[model samples]
Target: MYAQCPDCLTVFSMDAETLAQARGHVVCGHCETEFDALASLSSQLPPEPFQQLPEHKSSGRPPQVESAVYRPRQESALAADSGTTPAAESEDFSHLVFSPRFARPAHQNRMRRWPWVLACLVLLLLLCAQLAWAKRDALVVDPTAGTLLRQACNSLGCRLPLVQDVQHLRLLARDVQAHPSVPGALLISATVRNDADFDQPWPVVVVTLSDVDGKHVAMRRLRPSEYLGDGFALQRGLPSGTSTALVLEVEDPGNKAVAFEFSFE
Candidate 1:
């Protein structure tokens, strides 16, 4: 009763008798192409010749009546009489034959999957970045980590962490001596050590030279650029559990320099 055009995919309804008379050949009204109607036929059975349905408006006149009559061959008749139908119509759908228009294109499916795969990769990278940010403080101290970060920061234009808790810097020794080369000038010497388990940035050392009465006579604040000499190798900061000697020559205040206080800022 129902058949489709293989080329244009247009559906039309006709009686079994009419289909049999036409031998499955019909003209499509939509595309005006003559093709074998049975090639695109659906599974719906034809209505009995005597069955009459209500009439409705149509786009075109009904198909012309055909002159010839179609009949089953002897073997087909024998199989039908034996209550067995042909397996072609009832075969496994997975192995069913498909026309060109009905089959899905493999490349289209592959193209559609790429965006989701790319999105998943982006999310994975973002997760890794969040994790790295969470552990930045701990990673900065590792010598190997510092090297890697420096290389990455150089290209990406990012700044490295350069300061830590100044309380970790301990004053090991301190002494002041007269500068032999320059009169009225005092040479200050101090030993500072890092006590933390990891490396940290150099802190500003504030030295206050005081008199016997404990009154501050001269004060000086040393910055990182002033303290880190050319001999220092570790670019990031000072290594943990290590000591560095600080030497400074400055003018002696008029009052006696009996005591000194060192504070790391």
Candidate 2:
């Protein structure tokens, strides 16, 4: 029978009697390494026991080259003398045959991709959240988005920008004169208008009183409560395209209060 070496891949022939004497273990002639000869035996050999026979040449039949499949056998005396067991011998020959049961299935390989798929999905969700955070200012004007932002701000204890286009408040008219009731006091009158088509929050009005030289003498910042008074609810916001009158009395800065400027911030 022909035996091939697993280490050096050398093929050689040995008598079945000699192989049996060695307990299916033999040293390779080419590489001088010991291996189980029965594990590497070729299938081309006859299946019957080797016996005395005359050598002859075959003219018609072609040789069949096939792989050998190993089956477990009883422990031989040579293996027992060497302190080897049948379990060890069976393990040594386990690589001789290929079985469908021992092979991994395709579905099991597909299951291994689940973790990567889950990771990609989580990454996509994080990307969407980042985009929403970047566009938060533009989205805050929507009614539903404003409500959601307010609710989240309430829970998180953060401030929410619920309105947009509130900076459209325009300056309309201004009149500065001396106070009628108080002595040596000046009265400032102004009319502010909101040109925007939407109701918006009020802004802080800044008044700077300048002398004849254009140098500021007195400056005061008026809030919505000071100008609109308790009559109009400040939280109710300012109406669009409407005008409001403001009257403020301030102490005379001693120098002539001239060239006063009014601004809303």
Candidate 3:
């Protein structure tokens, strides 16, 4: 019987012994491609296998070409020899097409991309949260951003520093005079007012004592605790649109200290 290699379409003789030994799987002798020989087994050749030359033939019959495979496009050239019909000409010959059996899998499953994108977004959000927490003190200066941060902090059970707006705070009044009981000392006092609608922390008072020539004589930076004691107002923050008194006593810079200036931070 005859068998055709499904890969290279090489036609060759097959026996029961060889078919049983390989389980109908045979390697093509012409192209060395391995395929199931039983898939395209046939009793005879083409419709014709290949072109037949008459000059090399001594007999009326065609030469026996062992490695030749059928090609229907060349069948009409040998029609007088095989006498094949039009019905046989339309038969399926798809098995004779060559295809690589060892390439890629036909049904491979791929990993989706959205999971990776979601992970990246989560990491980015975490980074932004960290940055916001680190700069919360600076962010509280903005009215809108501070409101959002305060609301978030309330829900998250976290506390943020009070809003400090130097522009909203100013000295309502100031006084500098000799200390009552202390010798060679001067007493400094100022009334600072908060103009904003919201309550804020007490500002650091920067006192600059200048000489008669308007040159700086002495400087002092006093925190709320230094001038106001450890009172509830220091922690609860100063009320809005109100004024607070500040008193401090310092050693006088001799008689050249004739002028003094006050600033708040």
Candidate 4:
């Protein structure tokens, strides 16, 4: 049967009977290479063992004798018998598995996905923080308005006289001129509108006047008037060349205040 050695590309023939009993091992005569001979020739042989031995070896030597065993052909003898080039019998196939090789570790593939997951988590946290800030009704006012009002009220103790018929309003501070001893009063007006649909009366405005040092010099609530026109007013005595900032706070029933400040030069 024709056989090719894996270690050395040598093609040789063996007796049909010896090949059947050889199992997988075969020894090459040219290169003396031992290889699995049955691997490549399994498809060419019959499934059952051969029943007869060669007729020539039965008479001189018993077919089962060691001398009757098959022998590999020498390199020179194989070339002479085939009448072919000696180099053609041996072929090289070492580069077949190495041509295109690509390998990667399993951990490296898993690590590459972590950056994308972290980026998505950071983006999700920032979006949630922005939504939380927007849901709050916190009010922020400029510091300049608070600084100016306190200075005017500290110098003059004049208080504006309260007019009745104003129920939901409380007079936090009223500064009015009392002859030449007090400076001319600066009048500040503030109003709060109950935009809610519920029929509930609640304090919605807080007006405060402070000194230049941010101390609360005068504070008042512009109570809701019975007539429902002007809610509250603050009158602060002002000397010549004196400036004051009037801070008006409008708060809903929920006690969330939105503030506005005006400067009287």
Candidate 5:
């Protein structure tokens, strides 16, 4: 078998029968180069059992060639004979014969994408939860509820137009009579201004009533016309000599109601 020196690129031949014996240290005839012939022919050679050669005694005659150095041209010629180029021969590659040590696992490849999918799912759920929470108090009114709301608004002192429908309403009532000389009644009203603005129809109103003794006397709903035009009318059936303070409140589907407050006397 023929081998090429990697460092000096010298070519040499070894006896086929003695190839295994001619391994590690061998003398090259052409360039008179010494090389690790076994390593140089690794691709074209197979492994052999470790064996030590008997030491050679020096010859009496002076050496014909003083230095045996391999050359690049000789290396190329040897590579061509071996059906390979010198560049191809010296490449540090073991992949042709052995697999890589660290190959990626199939599960690891799939797991790399999971975090993004999980995040998207979590974001979608959060969006749905937020939407539900935002609409939690959305009111769905029927004709009956609309009528009741209208009637309640009319019973208070606030004056408002006839309400068509109510979509949402929030009412807050409080009693504060500490400011005595002020009117004993508190009124609130709301209404829709135009048909184009009917999408959000319901309006909320708050009313507070208080008396000179820091007490609330009477509270009731008033009609839009009554509230806007004048103070709400007192309901009948009170004792003739008794005095009662009143507060009025009203909410109109349309924002056309007027809110006001005054003492019944």
Candidate 6:
């Protein structure tokens, strides 16, 4: 019988004695790949012109023109052959348990993720900026938030609008008297104190005049510049934990105006 080397297609003559040596496990004398020699046993070689056989139709080995037992490994070398596969031959593997797909290097994988990381950081910053702007009126009065907002605005060359903390302002004293020199005029005076730890924008002082029956007769809103007069005091705002006196002059609302009440806004 003849057996073909599935790897190199070099055929070797085989007999029962030689085939049973390693239970049909034989190494090709030419290519040295081990295979089941009995699987490819044939009675005779193919006729004449050597043509490459389609690997899928036959075996995976490329076709060879002629087939013959390698003279040295079979005839002269058989007696010297040990007939057992050596331990080092394990490196010539024909089967694998699993195959791995292509993978990028560690740094390359990290590089590809950097853009997404940067985009997330930028989105977080935008969210914080939007929150600061939307709650500017509230945040600007917060000591911590105010400092952060001021630093950010200063860096961006932005002008922050002044905001009042009316709840923290106390109307310490008030007086509504007829103007001494101005006829039919009322001179309104009040002491406003800021109860907060921080300086706040000047509050609008609201004065309500009512009659004996407690019916509202007139009302007035006094701004800082109008009542304080001094540009320095108006610009500096109400100082923290301090009192400032303000005065307002307006035409009296006739006999109906008897009592007055004051509030800060």
* Best-matching candidate per TM-score: 6
Q: Select the stronger candidate by TM-score from 1 and 3.
A: 1
Residue range with the least summed lDDT across 10 consecutive positions in model 5: 194-203
What lDDT is obtained when candidate 4 is compared to the true structure?
0.42
TM-score-best of 4 and 6? 6
Question: Ranking under TM-score, best-scoring first?
Answer: 6, 1, 3, 2, 4, 5
Please write out the lDDT profile of model 6 over residues 1-265, one tens digit for every residue. Answer: 6777778877777766676557888988898799887677765667756442223245789678787634323432443486655443324333322212223357877888999999999999999989877887788788887778778877999757667778888888888899999999999888878887556888777888999999999998877667777787677677778987778897799999889998877
The runs of at least 3 residues in candidate 5 whose Cα sits more than 4 Å from the true structure, single-residue gaps closed, are 1-104, 138-265
Tens digits of per-residue lDDT for model 4 on 1-265? 5566655555555544556566657788888888666555532433445432222222565455456534555777777889965765554443333211122346776688799999999999999868744542221111343233334434675322221221323233433222343243333443333222111233334455455555555545554342134333222212222222333333222212223232211
Clashes of 1: 0
TM-score versus the correct structure, for each prediction: 0.50, 0.41, 0.47, 0.21, 0.20, 0.52
Off by more than 4 A, model 1: 1-111, 127-135, 138-163, 231-236
lDDT of 5 by residue, 152-230 (tens): 6569854223223332222223342223343432233222232211123222222424455545544444443344333
Query: Which parts of model 6 have CA positions greater than 4 angstroms off?
Result: 1-102, 141-161, 223-225, 228-236, 254-256
Local distance difference test, each candidate? 0.72, 0.71, 0.75, 0.42, 0.42, 0.75
- What does candidate 3's lDDT look like per residue over 1-265, in tens digits? 5776655656687765677779988888888898777666655555564532111214678668888665456566566568864346466754443433332245421235567878999999999989987887677766788778778877999767777788889788999999999999889988888887456888888889998899998998888888877688789888778888889987888888889999887
- Between prediction 2 and prediction 5, which has the larger TM-score? 2
Clashes of each: 0, 0, 0, 16, 19, 0
Name the better of 4 and 5 by TM-score. Answer: 4
